[model samples]
Target: MHDSHSERMSGSETRAASGLALVFAFRMLGMFMVLPVLATYGQDLAGATPALIGLAIGAYGLTQAVLQIPFGIISDRIGRLPVIYIGLLIFAAGAALAANADSIWGVIAGRVLQGAGAISAAVMALLSDLTREQHRTKAMAMIGMSIGVSFAVAMVVGPLLTRAFGLSGLFWATAIMALLGIVIVAAMVPRASHPLQHRESGVARQALLPTLKHPDLLRLDFGILALHAILMASFVALPLALVEKAGLPKEEHWWVYLTALLVGFFGMVPFIIYGEKKRQMKKVLVGAVAVLFLCELFFWQFGNSLRALVFGTILFFTAFNLLEASLPSLISKVAPAGGKGTAMGVYSTSQFLGAALGGILGGWLYQHGGLSTVFVGCAVVCAIWLAIAVTMREPPYVTSLRLPLSAAAVADTGLVTRMLAMPGVADAVVVAEEAAIYIKVDSEKLDRTSLESLIESAPERAEA
Candidate 1:
């Protein structure tokens, strides 16, 4: 009857999306605020060793990677709100523990506990529960933007907070943020009247095997893992380099990050536009990885000068942000129809594991071979990723849609055949139990008016 995609988000839908985005932002802000300052101040803890400090930096990722999916599955059984409350409380407690800890081991324990909260999947599931299928993509995109902003803000804020309040105070602030997230959940977030498992939003058990075995998806996963490994490892040395080589003081570090992040954020926009608009995503991705390789090399060779540190940091983030933004979009493109959530779940887990690996790699290399060694190690990792990324097939530029279907449509045995026969319909899945259809379509080629007309026209019912 009407263009299904044309519907705007209702007031309730808008509220739900915005509130959940805030919750996501709060949690991530807490997780990331430590990245910039940890290396400089972490050494003050009792019995702190470089390796152990690295562990402290990455400990949360280990637990987060393990528990992320389990938390979502658990929410499916117990309900979304309860799981969110519990996650926030656990996160707060962990932050408090770290704030009070005196030894490196204790801080590591705190970080592990912090990661154990693992509520990202749960939050996304909740968002899915609250939004209409037509608006779900937009809702999810809002959450994604919030995360990117949170990371940028954290990088700038971390140094400022650490300098003003010290390490313990920084942890305490994260604890407060977690507690605040609980308040937002209770006071602001709307309750989902019915929570359904969405193949596009929540991980599907049946979809996991195929998603994991997907060669291109697997390559992308490795790419994220390598990307984060470089991030953690680089951060482990970056602060030290700034202080020792650039002769910058610890308190002034925020200025460098703020400026670099600002430059990086703006610098990547043209590349993103070129990639998406020009349909040269593979070229952009490969080129970004290559830039990453060179940036690491620059850091290893000439990072001792102040200008090099600043310029190199700016270049590094430009490439880093581009890849970070590109990888998820690529995952969406590469994943099978109806398996986006599962593919993303696996990709996220790989990312966390990489964070853990990078921390340890950075620490050991820095300790044994000095600051340059960390860059060397990160350069090698980027080199490997560059090699792998070059072989990726050109992605199909398509938009994914999950639409609620009428019972008659669900019962129509030939519904998929009819849709697939459409000019721009790339893939379709009729999941009867979920009372919905998942589709991938080339936006440029798809005639939305005709497609909707066919869907509403009539269904060829299966023979009873």
Candidate 2:
């Protein structure tokens, strides 16, 4: 409704957000640090094969996808920190296992264990617990920024670490980082004063079916799935292409990653501004998918040349960063009222599953048909995604508003109807159990003052 609604965070909100952001960054850094070097270095492991190596690279996603919902459910039952602490311990154990392993299967097993720690939902829930409703979006934004920064940092530093110590050394470092995350959770993050229902933050089991059935949300889910599948599958070939074909040493791999990421980051900004400010998100999104298709074609044709590889990489990351930032925004804009958390949970699961499928499929393609085939597959996926995206409706420019409702308002059958009839309100859900009403409203058209007055005028009575 107004910019001031989220402008300031309380001292506690700041502290909690910062602490949790660091914890999330550390965990993600562990997962991403191996992406650039894994294809090449993993060959030294016993029982290594291209297919097995691809499995190892993507093994974490399999476990992460499987455990994510369970971890969230456990956290809801047992409390957030306990679940987080257990998850970190599992991650550390996985890291240690990977560090000591001599075979690709061992590494895969370790990666699976690492992913089993699945604390993302718990961490977000904890952040929601620590911040006020008005400030929750800003707090979540902090975590999102932390993830982007972590990806950049991992790409730059991962090669350096691997060169200095070796693959096992990198695993050891990840284990150490996981341990550090445990310490941060225990000492740095603030505890909630009491257990919170966290309807806004945690998934509601009942909302799952409806969220899955929503056609727009289903499209977004498939978009993320295709996006990450391409991402993981591409890397199966990209690192090897850099070394064997492009003639870059493994040690110098970071140069390509760092340069490409920097260029891509800068390139993504203008598109994002145009998409948001110009209200041209669908256009930008489809354009990015087309660019992704072109990038795959470039890789397929010109991957052997150093100069072409770099150029294609820059273009690839540019398209990637844009899509990565835009998809979640689209979800928020399209998700039905009271179903945001459920929609997000499904979206995340799709992303992780895509990563796992990408690894497996990419490995198979590379093993049987070579790198060119992998690129061809990725291009085909992008082509399909682009075709589907083109037919989708433009997402409404709406923000969800949560308002406190009196007991009488909760009992009133017409509350949701009245809210939806109000100017700019696109959807409304009234939850009697929580005594709250959630509405999606077009910010530019919303009459905040009138909405407030309407809520104030709603009849009041004690619960029966």
Candidate 3:
């Protein structure tokens, strides 16, 4: 809400955000590549019974969900870069293990270790620290954009790489890319020692409950989980259906993926513009979810036809992109401004867990219930998530103001309480060590000079 010039991204913050984006994209891109081919590839591996194979495929997600928050908390206490470096190193080890696995168990072990490096939460926290509160959203948007780009690229290239070098080669390539990412992070990011008093490294103990209690926030979180679940499940079924029902060759699936990604990307622009520029985020979000629901229904009935699969897949992705971009923006608009980073952490965890559940459940359903059941199950999940989202209240935009305080001023709880009552102030948190007061307020109401006047007279400081 506040247009204070403080929100502008400084040059250093921009470069730091860019580096963080590369880390997120590189890590995610590798994981996504397996989605397109896992079910098919698993069938050919020697020790992969159908049941065990799904476990192997989905294991990475479970580990990632379990570790992300802890990893983030560790970064807060230990240093973001160090934690990140450890994660990348673990990821590289996992990659090499998976690359050389002769049995399904070995692949599963690799996946579990890979999940252990879960650095996404840490990466996000670092971005927040690097930029001013005013520029936080833009910095976050860049991260979101990077993830979208990575997923798109992975989808397009996966099948081609599978054809060119086989699945093992994909793992090897990801390993190499991760090591390269480690080099980038260590060499490019600033490495000054942070005083323990000046920075937080570990996970916040209070993250989950507050995030879960907010109805609007909960709705968005549920939607993300459902959205990613649908994505994971559909890929499980789509490629096999394409080859078996539609008579497309396996290698040529890339042709379809490339076409759909390119087109779906362009198709999402109008909805994004409408949501942001026209203030129609809710309307657009609902419409996209509705479209995706119908696409699932259509796929259930007609996915056997190549043309029908192509049309349905394209529609699914277009709606997915629209919802994905819109949801995080909506979260920023709605979250209690003081707790945005925490909210995102919870949201990210739910999504990774949902993807894990989807892979296992979808695989089992495919093995037992066949095509009709798998499609029906995912459609029902989407329909329920849609109902939950439609009932949420829309949120107003928020802006934060930060006031630098003297070390002595940081100890005055009474002074901090008084500032919370100021006109337009909604929430306040004072970090004494940094002499910074993070305040949420109506974006339209920032009066910097008056706010500074208040800060100058804080109880611990002499009124000047």
Which prediction has the highest TM-score against the true structure?
1
lDDT for predicted candidate 2 compared with the true structure: 0.88
List clash counts for every candidate, in order. 0, 0, 11
Kindly indicate the candidate among 1 and 3 with the higher TM-score: 1
Q: Tell me, what's the RMSD of every candidate?
A: 1.5, 2.2, 3.4
Clashing residue pairs, candidate 1?
A: none
| Candidate 1 residue 292 C-alpha distance from true site, Å | 0.8
C-alpha lDDT values of all predictions: 0.90, 0.88, 0.77
Candidate 2 Cα errors over 4 Å, as ranges = 1-7, 460-464
lDDT per residue for candidate 3 within 1-464, as digits (tens), equals: 25436646767778888888898888888888887776666667778764566666677889899998888877877778888889999998998999898787888788888888899877877776776656766787788899999999998787888889887888898898789889878766655345232222223455457767988898998888888888777776788788888998888888787788888899999888977766677888889888988988998998888999999888988998888888877766676634666777777788888888777777777878776677887899889988987897755655555556775567666766777777777777886545777677765665667777777777535432
Ranking by lDDT: 1, 2, 3
Off by over 4 Å in 3: 1-11, 49-53, 192-203, 406-426, 431-434, 444-464
TM-score of 2: 0.97
Clashing pairs in 2: none
Model 3, C-alpha of 324: deviation from truth (Å): 1.7
Q: What is the C-alpha lDDT profile of model 2 across 1-464, one tens digit per residue?
A: 56436578877789899999999999999998988878889989999888888888788999899988788888888999999999999999999999999999999999999999999989988897898777888898899889888988998888999999999999999999999999888888888986566566778888899888888898889999999899889988999999888899989999899999999999999999999888898999999999999999999988888898999999999999899889988998898887787788888889999888888888888999999999999999999999999988989888877777887777777667777788899998887777888889998999999997777666742232
TM-score of each predicted structure versus truth: 0.97, 0.97, 0.89
Predicted model with the maximum lDDT: 1
Better of 1 and 2 by lDDT: 1
